[model samples]
Target: MSMVRYKAIIAYDGTLFHGFQRQPQGRTVQEELERTLSKMASQPIVVHGSGRTDAHVHALGQVIHFDYPKERPLEKMRFAMDTQTPEDIAVKQVEIVDELFHARYLVQEKVYEFHVQIGKPRSPFRRHYASYYPYPLDLAKIERALPDLLGTHDFSAFCASGSSVEDKVRTIYEATMVHDEALSELVFTFRGDGFLYKMIRILVGTLLKIGNGRLEETSLPKIIASKDRNCAGPTAHPEGLYLKEVKY
Candidate 1:
């Protein structure tokens, strides 16, 4: 028949996989999906992901697109692929899209959430998903620092040390910190047009430093002005970060 393009919403617990992108060794979400699709079609198949999540990072609503010459029903294709994938990775839904549709370049915005547990004992079951800080945090200080990060700015200060991107500017649409005392969890939520490498983790680290009285709340602007990664706080662990959603 004719060629067809398919789009799918994928979710996975990235703890076991190397990362979203395919690698020569170690399991990866994209590699596994492509391998299954290749077997079913009896031909080579490649899956393109909207974003590249680092190792040990999870995605709740990741998008992927691929093309094939054979026309198979979307539901049946999903079922066949799901059967081959491990329990940690799941295909949530699939649809046929126009040939020009892409999973990555067409995205409008992305939302990421970093989960942190503040004070007291840690939950054994959730140790893999959340970052635990035993000391008390000053929510007021963190809230005060949020506004400085709201508008567009050069985010070089918040990026990881080894990032190679030349342009460090990014527009943060919204930045908020919420605390659920009952759950004993602190959630840092950010919606942005795009992000620098490890930007969110560094931002969260700086906020935690401010909350712990190690840094001044007013120091945020100066940190951003410095445009140096070393001036920022430590990069938070990857396990606590989640790709919450991608808005097209």
Candidate 2:
């Protein structure tokens, strides 16, 4: 039978896994996907992700691709995998695709969302998925600093320490901050060509700092110009981050 390439859209609650990538210890999305697919195929299988979402970071529509025998009906396979995989992980869609199609390399853009619970105490329901900031935030100030983040710039200041990627520049196609009064939560959404490790979280941390009067809004341009990681604010917690979408 001819080998066929299969593309899949997946969603996972990352709280249980070490991260998207397989590790020496602890569960991971990739490890589980490969293991389940390999069992069905009766051979070792590999799956590639659009990008890695850090530990406790959830994905609403993470994309991946792998190969399987042409004899496998994708609809049946998707159902089977969904039934067999852990409850936190779900195979949303599976399709046969062009041999050249690759999940990571063809990615044109990505969207990530960071959630923050503001004022008083953290919500028990959102504790594993939202960062809690007890202090009042100046919403207007946070909105003002967001525009400087649009367009292309070297975001070295917003990237985490020990990242090996040399190109620190990334283009922000769009970004916004919205306050959900009903939930008492502040939501930050980002769409970009790509992101460095912990980039979104660090960006949120800096915005929070600015909102709380710890960082000057006018200093944003200078911070980007500095290119030093020390110029940025603290790295926000991983739980508040979600890989909202992976655009091809």
Candidate 3:
């Protein structure tokens, strides 16, 4: 049978799914997407995602590419999946791309936003979408640490234990923290060449500590130099993390 490569942009709440990647048992974003494609195509379809996100994490612009057995208009394929897929996930866009355009490898950079609620009691609307940290933060402390994090560096300290990628180096294009006065939340946006397992969360966690005086602002440089996970701060919760966008 012949095949056509289809690229799709999808967004998911990620609250219910186990994770972005398929697991041995429970449901996942990839499994759900593949299942939807398999049912629609009347044959098994393999889908590959831009990256794997942990459980409870969300994505606003997750990318995927799959080989479809049937030849059909891109719009039809998108619509067919959008109307029938579960409510939490959505098909934002679809296109027929060059066969070599992999969703993962072709990615030029990725942007992730981590939200931390600073209010004493988290708002009902923001509770699930952002992480709640009631402690006071020293904004200037967090600010002072941002510039040191930019540029290419060996980020082994920020990544978690499971990653096997030998080259723990990644370039941070932009690392900015903005306070949303209306929401009373601290939003940290990280744009980078790539992120490793729990890297953003760890970086944010370290910054959060520095903001609260739990960790010194000068600790960032040493953490990067150490290249040891034990030297960094804890990994923040997954709920606050979001895969904002991936640019090719």
Candidate 4:
């Protein structure tokens, strides 16, 4: 049988795995899926993800594509892969697609969420799920600073050092924050065409700094103009980051 291209949406806890990519030294989301799928296919199966998430970054609707040696029903493949993979990783949806559907390149928009816990005592249950900040936050300051992030900008200041992507320009379609009173957490959502390595995390960190008065509210635009990573605040904790969705 000819190879069949399958597209899948998956979610993983990401706390224990190294990252989404397959690495020689560590267990990764791709390695796990490839291992299980290859066993079922009776041949090697390489999975291509929409994008790579750093270690400890969780996902709710991460998309991936791979080729199977033989054809199979989409539901059956989804069920088999879902059950066979480890407990933390879930194969949520599966469908056969055209061979041209490249998960990474064809992506049009990606949505990410960053959670921040702002309380006196840290909750044990949220240790690995949210970044904790005990400092007093000025919501107005953060709200005022957010408009600076909208639209297209050269975000080299927010990109992590290890990224090799030459083009640093990207558009931010949406950037908003919500305070979840029930959980006492600040949830930040960002929708963009593409993001640089650790861009969201760095943006969240800098925003938090602005909220806490560490950084001037008007300084974000200057920092972006500077295009200097050193001008940005520290990268936020990986645990609070989540790959929320990918749009075609």
Model 4 weakest lDDT span, ten residues long: 68-77
Question: Residue 76 in candidate 2 has what lDDT?
Answer: 94
Candidate No. with top TM-score: 4
Residue-level lDDT of model 1, residues 1-248, one tens digit each, is 67799998888998898889998888899988888888877889899999788888898888999987677888997887677888898888888999999999998899999999876678886788888878767889999998899888999899886777799989999999888778688889999988888888889999999998899999889999999778888888888888888888
Per-candidate total of colliding backbone pairs: 0, 0, 0, 0
Q: What's each prediction's TM-score?
A: 0.95, 0.97, 0.97, 0.98
lDDT of 3 at 9: 93
Candidates by lDDT, descending order: 4, 3, 2, 1
User: On residues 36-152, what C-alpha lDDT tens digit does candidate 2 reach at each position?
Assistant: 989988898899999888889999899999888755777898899898888999999988899999999999999999999997767899898889999868889999999999999
Candidate 4 collision pairs:
none
Error of 4 at 225 (Å): 0.2
Ten-residue region with minimum lDDT total, candidate 3: 119-128
Candidate 3 versus truth, CA RMSD in Å, comes to 1.1
Q: What is the lDDT of residue 53 in candidate 3?
A: 94
What tens digits encode model 4's per-residue C-alpha lDDT throughout 1-248? 78999999999998998999988888899999999999998899999999999999999999999999878888999999999999999999999999999999999999999999998798898998999999899999999999899999999999999898999999999999999998999999999999999999999999999999999999999999999999999999999999999999
TM-score of 3: 0.97
Candidate 4 ranges with C-alpha deviation above 4 Å: none
All predictions: root-mean-square deviation over Cα?
1.4, 1.1, 1.1, 0.8
**lDDT value for model 2:** 0.90
Which segments of model 3 are wrong by more than 4 Å?
none
Give Cα-based local distance difference scores for all models.
0.87, 0.90, 0.92, 0.95
lDDT of 3 at 233: 86
